[model samples]
Target: MTSGLQQKNSILILDFGSQYTQLIARRVRENKVYSTIVSHKITAEEIKKQAPKGLIFSGGPASVYDEKSPKCDKGIFKLGIPILGICYGQQLIAQYFGGKVRRTREREFGRQELFIDDHADFFSGLPGNITCWMSHGDYVSSLPKGFVSIAHTLSTPNAAFASRDRKVFGVQFHPEVVHTARGSEIISNFLYRICRCRPSWEMGAFIKDTVSHIRQLVGKDSVVCGLSGGVDSSVAAVLIHRAIGRQLRCIFVDNGLVRNREPEEIKTIFRANLHMNLDFVNAQNRFLKRLKGVTDPEVKRKTIGDEFIKVFEEEAKKIRRVKYLAQGTLYPDVIESVSATGSPSAKIKTHHNVGGLPEKMNLKLIEPLRELFKDEVRELAKQLGLPQEIIHRQPFPGPGLAIRIVGEVTPERLQVLRDADDIFVGEIRKAGLYNEVWQSFCVLLCIKSVGVMGDERTYENVIALRCVSSSDGMTADWVKLEPALLGKVSSRIINEVKGVNRVVYDISSKPPSTIEWE
Candidate 1:
């Protein structure tokens, strides 16, 4: 099934094309209720099939007054499931069922106080006058039939509304966003108290279930998995290898996208622990030779993606009777329908997906960790008794430093960036910021600037340090690193790394900027 979360206590998020729609899913998953995000244009027939425990309407960019605003049919309301709507979702619910949406010139674009009324099911254990993140242009002035107002802000009188009989709830402010104090608790209240879903969604059960399912699916057939030594693929390899034992063939592709000593380190871990049939394909020359002079980002992505598949295919031909190809794809890579910045088509870089193979490969797709987020995958890995070093490792792009280099993939540039990145990550660990950041890396910019290192003019490659704190990789804020820490990191990188003279910190958030530059 395309809906990967079918077997769990699911929360269905009918995406209203909101940037934070995925955030709603992340929040639900945090409550241990597996959630799926489907397009708002989905018919009621589709909603009926998923059989969600609860329904949530996500906020969108569209105003309720738009002639072509996104909305779901009223028939979904009658599904007898607990429904909670956010921002534009609240407006949609109110507009459809005898509520008035007024366009206010004053926009509540940031934090707002929620004065909670105790007479509702939504505010079970939450306190009154709590702050929530608000981002909307329109406000719901009137309530829908059988829906009474339970909470309000200074500007929004109908901030929250509910129907006692129907078990419907709506909130004008986004509880999914982090700026909202006690937002997670409110979301938890909806999932546990309101919908009453079972809390059986832990990692231990997931590992057991996935292992069982993999055993059933592959039987005794040989499966080839690409192990990039990143958490995703490494964890996937460990899980699948544990289930199938000798049947799983792991191909560690040293695409030269890896850091110095990475291939050696990966070989050590897999060989020592799993002891399965491991093949190391040194495709660095192939990848770097193909990526030479590729300046355009999309072109680089396509070239890398295409070349990766070809290498994988070539490697697959060597191993006889390998009928399945496994990848370490996660939920964020699949669940995200739109970028958080509300950009055009949400141009995705092809670091993770080697662009799903053509018909000729004839390999059945096996993604054991497809349904899980990265953290959950780590948890599953831990349950499967994988080493802690492999489990707690930070995320590196499938294309590795190639994407981080920004312009082209060259051996010279890669070496410099690799050293700098190593130093940066090493120093971060020394300062104890490794666990705090979801991802932190050094970007090797193509441009070089003049710098004075001990009274000598040196024009060298520039490195941009990016460290963002995020629960999920969905929405993120730049980590407020201390000046002394930054100074130490900069001094170490400039002195130790031969590639560059300059070190810059990225202070941009995810809306106008993504974690990765390319």
Candidate 2:
């Protein structure tokens, strides 16, 4: 789906392998213009093919001094598109075009106050003493002829530069990340004033366009969506179904990790409101069989992943030549997985917590939400009139309870963890916390801890409850629950769930700890 403004104001972001490059695309989309992240090595012909209104160079973890550091061909500059260069991007722009760059004795990182000079086009509407995220080891010492320094930090004088005549802008700091206060406004300024893009990106128009796109892509051929009942997959299914009616088939395999009653709810919605083909497969036995005795987290992940693909392949084969495999792959995965930098994007964290997919699957992929962030997907979900239960459901990894259950996959353990998790989420919902928090769930630790219950010493599994506050799942801080609320949750889980003797809350955030333990 494309918005009118999105159609007209398309921006091509050349990836320099910056970890936050996808974050940049997310920020730009939030501003109401569609942005695409492409590798810096993308050919001039490819850029011409996209026909972007503006171009942006993403910052990378590389220094310009490195021999193999990423660089675009000189032809990119002469493309006549309004160009924006971030950190490494800025350094590349200057160094290649007769500017000087030097490694800093003391690298600038983390939060810094930006001092914007009136001459800077990128900071036209931005305020002085603005906060921005900086993560660069090298600094731009000089600018090419005709270019002017527009902004700077105390440590870095050439923080920002612009050549209004050429429509070229560069920033040494990242405006895509939240660490930069007013980052969104700075991006909007570039999109609206400099790039001259109209704010035509909207969710409603996107839905209409996506519906049309689906009709064209899957003409007369049946399309199958691998629904996990999560926001991403479900939203994709709804949009496609709206576009093509019964031609869209949603197959939900109960891989046995979903929360209580999710499969049933999913079936009811798709059958009643969506009027699409809904198939529910209880593949719990097959998944558990494949995961039996797998203790290593990585091994378990691979096992489950392989098994899921096999199951999907088998189901697709039975369907007699399924043309497309629809997924909920988001923009972050597309950006990070296919980085512009020479480095493998696999080094970065995954958008989905699930294990990698087997490469042998032959079905053509159809991912409707591939260009959107989690929040944007939600906006589209709301526009589609999906029930709040489905739309506002807390984020759950595709791997399901497998990651939550620290050890081997077994029916008994799955049941125990599922029950505890149900109580945990149920209480959170009872307190009106589901929509408020980004993710909230319970983890069943593999090790059994001793506890005293009434005069008896019981050896029981310990369950850890995790809840975090975040916009996207990229980075997060642990949610702060009141003492009363925590007490109630802890009491209920221990009392109601068998085999779970003790309950503890996970207070660690994403940096020191990932949302999931496994």
Candidate 3:
């Protein structure tokens, strides 16, 4: 049974392999309306069963003219519900409605000015011209029979089009991205004016509903949570505890892959302070033994996931009457780990918790926050009266420092990276910039560099610092740290961290590079 999320006021997003598909759902949720993602190959019969208030077609990298590009069922348009298409999605709408979409000489890849011709129906209350984010090579040369060009950019003559009578709309530029001016307003007009959806979804209501659902799901069975002391796990533990008080037990595993002194600190925060039924497992040797010589990221993740299950299975057997295993799995973990059926979305990386779906397990899995984003989990934490330290803590991956190191998992490499990362985080916190960025850490690059120390040339490991700022993990931009702060961090890591000679800063964004090195 699903929670109260699949309701009448929710929006359904058809995923066509766009990297920004999750962003579209986040935007709709920000409007306080629920949104879900499904494969574009889903039929109209399947769509009718969900009874979505509106449908949104996400932009993809493929062109509609390609022989093998992904496409949705054409019969979905007959449902008579409002639909909006963005970027490549617009190409499909144009091609299906008797319009011509042809390749342009040059692709528009950034912000452009869109001149609005009519602001009555689709482009309501907007001014003459507005800046919009454009990233497409194809343009609609001609409009459909009933569709009108509501807005146009210099490069794309039909930037935005609408068919009021058919309750269909298409925009060549992306409104979900912040690069476009008044992008949220454009989405708001579509959600309220076009779809007539209510702004009724909120975190408080979710907590109330989830607690009850968890109680019903786990009647008298004891539940075990793998607590990492991060916001997601903390929120999940607290929610489960509220449902079945003493029946919930949290296990904090010291896999020797976490930050320096993290295991003890987590124990202090949870066991000593919160006073929940907790277990501390020191399985560092078990994890390291299995992860030795594993270089491939997927292999490392799956190995760690397998080890975690084995450890949990042993621990659950000790805790009598336990039948449910819970973890802090979020939406991004599920999205990036698994691909939709018949969708072109690529699997970026495998999260240890989500990558290995339940296998050889006697206990059933329960994830309360699987449908929520990182920021949404933080909000849920605050609503649950969690302390600021827990609610505002930076995100940490389940694979931990294994993913931070570019190569094999060894005690020496882990220590070197840990020392460098400790210095980086310490400086950021001392400068009062710790909370300003989404995530800030140090990576131990696989290659080494030659440097001079005490009048002698020596080769040592190079440490790379990655820091990004973002509202959500979907899209990210590197944080422009101060020069003095960078200099201090570099000097401290070189002096304090053994085997690290030089420190470099990574300035790449999410599209070209991920936050982690591995």
Candidate 4:
């Protein structure tokens, strides 16, 4: 039996520090097949125990030729499980099999025309000449024994290769990326045709399994969850309550940094609707006092995290016998919060939920949704019979608008930001563009500019509108709002948000700029 919750016929993806590893998992889930991302250091015994239908190696930033490149157990190949390697994963396989791989003088990092051949069924039903997205610097120079080229690019002749007899496949170009035309179909071929996996991964089954797992992990212990009215925490609280009814207690903290009327809405949804054991904490002054004059993003996160732990600990004292703390910590949060599997991509930001708690808190953590993504959480929330409002709310930081304020956090600044953000989001919903984008919010910049308000020279804060389209929070692109919508939002912000005179839109993408300005 698998030690973890890896179900039958699921695909196990080994992460080699790839930024797109989570994307690969997301693509697999989109096909209705379960996918789990494990560390590359997983042992052969572990793979055999998991008994997954197939395995996929995620493309990583590391070069396989390097001495410190990540690796996996070689003996798993003998397990006869079908394997698909992408980019660095392909190079790792080629090198292990005595194939030649050399760094090209010119790095390949963009779109290329990939020509298919009749050697393998991986490209079956796809066009002979297909467009692919390539982002690897190294290429396989020679084929391994019994492996034949299935596809070729102008620069990368061994763009794709497979050993049909051994049920092994490798693709130089990322088939998981949407930029690659028919990329999803190519992956489907490997999944259905080669691995013989059925669409067994569904939200209904996931909720059941998670409920059972939570009941077992937290037996007879009182579990306390910090419910923020967001889909993640709300879903988590509901899920846990189902598992251990009445044993779970949800705490809704009025941290003073949340949006206008957010606490009231959260109260209505969870306390009134769900009928769960809910505690409302008024720690507005506590949080505001600590956050005064804090400018550095990291320090601000730490300060909030520290304060959160202190508050939770105090709450637990009143609740009595609270032994577990359930958080809505998702996979992307864990990935971005720290170096995942010692990847080259180290800590991006310290998410308050993941890094907020003290090392030795009285209540242990039980993050039932820690391994899931935002979209998956929404799916589960919908299946759990949650309202559309909870399922489709924009992603809010654990630190709330504190990170969005971009400077010293104060009550005066917080109120101004709350008004502006509320207007931006309300208008987005009114325009019917709310569901079109992954996240849309307003960031209050500390800087001020002189402006003429009815012929009077006034200096006021600027609110930057950030709207991005993304499958997960991993990589995001700016949403190009129509000029009319922008004009409406800008005009409303300048006129309505009292302290704000200027409204600007953020057009930067994730790599160069994160979703949040801070």
Task: Supply the TM-score for candidate 1.
Answer: 0.91
Which pairs clash in the backbone of model 1? none
Per-residue lDDT over 1-518 for candidate 3, one digit per residue giving the tens place of the 0 to 100 score = 23455487889999898878888888899999888888998899999998888999999878899999998899998999899999888889989999999998997787899899989756788889999988888888899999999999888889999999989999999999877888888888899999999997888888888999999999988999999989999999999999999999999889999998898888888888887898999999999999888899889999988888888989999987999999999877877887643578788888999876456677889999988888899999989888889999999999889999998989999999998988899899998988888999998889999999999998999999999998888778899999999999999999988898999999999766877766
lDDT tens digits, residues 270-361, model 1?
88766767899888888888888898876776677677778777888787777888889876765442242232224344444634344365
Per-residue lDDT value at 215 in model 2: 90
Q: Encode model 2's per-residue lDDT on 153-260: one tens digit a residue.
A: 888999888888989888999898777899888888898889988666778877878888889988888777888878888898888888877777788889887777
Please identify which of the two predictions, 2 or 4, would achieve the higher TM-score against the true structure: 4
**Candidate 3, which ten residues in sequence have the lowest lDDT sum?**
1-10
Mark the regions of model 3 whose C-alpha exceeds 4 Å error after superposition.
1-6, 340-342, 357-359
* Residue-level error in angstroms, candidate 2, position 235: 1.5
lDDT per residue for candidate 4 within 445-514, as digits (tens), equals 9799989988999999989999999888887889989999999989998998788889899999876468
Those runs of model 2 whose alpha carbons end farther than 4 Å from true positions after fitting are 1-7, 106-108, 143-145, 335-346, 349-355, 448-450, 455-459, 511-513
- Please give the TM-score that candidate 4 achieves against the real structure: 0.95
Best by TM-score: 3
- Each prediction's total of clashing residue pairs, residues at least 3 apart in sequence or on different chains, is 0, 1, 0, 0
lDDT measured at residue 305 in model 4 versus the true structure, 0 to 100: 84
> lDDT of candidate 3?
0.88
* lDDT (Cα, 0-100) at 422 in candidate 2: 85
Clash count, predicted structure 3: 0
Question: Considering summed lDDT, which 10 consecutive residues are worst modelled in model 1?
Answer: 337-346
Q: What is the descending TM-score order?
A: 3, 4, 1, 2
The stretch of ten residues in a row with the least summed lDDT in candidate 4 is: 1-10
